[model samples]
Target: MSVELSVGKKVSVTVPGSSANLGPGFDTLGLAVGIYDTVEVEVIASGLEVEVFGEGQGELPLDGSHLVVKAIRSGLAAADVHAPGLRVVCHNNIPQSRGLGSSAAAAVAGVAAANGLAGFPLSDAQVVQLSSAFEGHPDNAGASVLGGAVVSWTEVPVDGRTEPQFKAVNIPVHSDIKALALVPSFHVSTEAVRRVLPTDITHLDARFNVSRCAVMTVALQQDPSLLWEGTRDRLHQPYRADVMPVTAEWVNRLRNRGYAAYLSGAGPTIMVLGTEDVAQSLLDEAREQGIRVLPLEVAGPVEVKVLK
Candidate 1:
């Protein structure tokens, strides 16, 4: 399909923040939460421009250096479509590098904006594939684009003729499950956390994680009662403790309290999956300990609102 973008067309896309790795799933499972970052784009007469508000106000770049614009350029280039001069506005809430899929949301917002302006040429899977190129992985971007809970994986074609492939599928999660994020004051860089991990692990350790992840998928759909056992991991978090001691500390603390807690994707945020009663007890304890946490339910599907 080929369609030219008119100079005056405008579009807005809202993408949700995601918490990935969900313990043993490791770069494959992600759950979209209520937090969001929105991008509003409009065709203009000249060069790119952006305005930012809320989170990342001073620290995030607002010019062509902005992540949103770069994503849009990437998407347009992938489509072999030329986008006209555009104005992009970002109203952000997802904290960058907080294990909340902020970068994925920005990447998707930009691509979605470009697709909308170009008269919607790319499919959602195509959008995810291009956005994943910017993210270096598909887990977070897949959840952001597909919404709800999802499993994403990469496949490198054995045949040299085809490029590497990304596949994402929405998964069913019982409604009784809820997620609470026990956030910290500081941010942990994804690279920093990854750098701290050991390159190898014992075979037994690998088996333990694989077992839990396998159970976790069925448990989330069939019965959430097993979450306490399902969210266990031995892969990265143990080694990453040195980078963010608080996250490691709380995982032990909350688990000891009988709550299923795990690092929220290279995080300083601990994701607690439980029922409402468990959530209440968590809040009570958090209040007493002076910890900050956000109660989040699974997010709805990603949306594009085009204003004609």
Candidate 2:
């Protein structure tokens, strides 16, 4: 493909919001949803400019300190392509500071937008790499770059810089499997969630999660009826419960009602996978338990799309 030239021009990229670390796949799994954050970038004359219109509206910055701008800079540096000036507009619908992979979406959108405005110089894999650099993890970045449900993980080095390694696998999901997210009013920082978790886990917990993770991965291939078997975990959830008591309570309530629920990322969000028959009841149970719910279907097929 010859370069699609656009000098002193504009381009845009819209990246979907994601939910990561479903149960046993802690720090390694992510599912992209329909909700998105759209970024528009234009080459200009002198400096960087950013505008945010949704989600974090007043709180999100417009300067170089902004996460989107930082990602655009990273992409430019990686591709060695610099514009005279940049005009950026972000239509952000993803919730921030809520374990919903909002930062990852913004980072991927920034990088992808920059790459497009720079004439599609970098490949999709390279775009993933650049976004991963800004966000520091590939789980969410992978899903943002490659849409739908993606199982991904990171490999960081002791020397500081790292490589984000991920493979996009499209799994066929059974119809009844709905991913219901209960986002609490409270916020839990990834750092704070990590702080509350034990640095080292017990061998029993390790073994238990390993077995369940394997089962979960296999279950994705076979049947949604087996979701409960796949969603059980003993490793991270128990230790990270302090920031997620709402998750535990709601999940337990769901299990009792015959639905499978798990912690979505390092959460304040609880995810329950269920059928249409009981989906409403699950939501009702969660609300009855005083937890707020946002019910959405899982994004399937696992294909990557770069919108410009």
Candidate 3:
């Protein structure tokens, strides 16, 4: 019998979905949600075996090309270990391509599981680095890695290098505050949505968002009741509205109905943040509009736990 360079074993990792830019944080703020992507990694006698369930259903590939597999491979390569023959099973509960940080969850799950399978050869930092590398952004990946809520920034590393450093601030996400997600029965590419954003932002608008972002983080930390007044944005959302007219219209409706509605990432899904009563009311309106509403309780804490 031939000996393998890397001994593969089964490991599981779960990552919560995240919503970035909650309102004014714009590529800085991210909140982990109740939704998750679970990944099980096990050794196989052959090449990579990828089986996907839930969200990506018919759309995902069962090959090394998938984001999860790619993250695992990247983790292995970074640790200078040979990529092992493995079987990957993914249960994706978060909606993909709907601005719910689906790719971030998948990437985080893969790296976390790979690190476990590799006998912890890679440190947590390495895993974050690997995930961030593949994801091309740290906001989502960092939030997934750290859990809870993260506000981060990308900085050019020394020697003309580029990398991102993130800090996770534990904010008191209100228990009474619920997330009412209004998801359309359609898919929109993140690239297409990004294309609609203006390259240059006005100084006044930038200042406005900066002020609101500060207010949002502090308000969520101290008094979440201020969330409605705090979660305001002057950047990105308005510019990207052309790509998500339905979401925009619905957000306006929610706001008019006295709820705080904001774009969830590069959204086709608008998140209505409010108390239970407002959430229920928003849900009812979503039903009336034929929009499926996923009511997720405000996520509490930043840490990944194995469900099984």
Candidate achieving higher TM-score, 1 or 3? 1
- Those runs of model 1 whose alpha carbons end farther than 4 Å from true positions after fitting are 1-4, 158-163, 278-291
**Model 2: per-residue Cα lDDT over 1-308, one tens digit each:** 22322446777676777877667877677777666787778877787778889888999887989988988878777667777788888888777877778888888887877676665677777777777766566777777777656677565566775554544444455555666677777777888787877678889888887887777766655666667877888877877775577667776777777776788777777777656444576667667866666767665322223333
> With candidate 2 superimposed using the best TM-score fit, by how many Å does residue 249's alpha carbon deviate from the native?
1.5
List TM-score per model, in order.
0.93, 0.87, 0.89
Report lDDT (CA) for all predictions.
0.84, 0.72, 0.75
Off by over 4 Å in 3: 1-8, 158-175, 279-281, 300-308
After the best TM-score superposition of candidate 2, give how far the Cα of residue 31 lies from its true spot, in angstroms: 1.2
Scored against the true structure, residue 89 in model 3 reaches a CA lDDT of 90
Q: Which candidate has the highest TM-score of all?
A: 1
Instruction: Please give the ranking of all candidate structures by TM-score, highest first, separated by commas.
Output: 1, 3, 2
- Tens digits of per-residue lDDT for model 3, 131-216: 77765667777777776677776665677655545334445565566676788877888888888888898899889988888888
Model 3 CA lDDT for position 66: 93
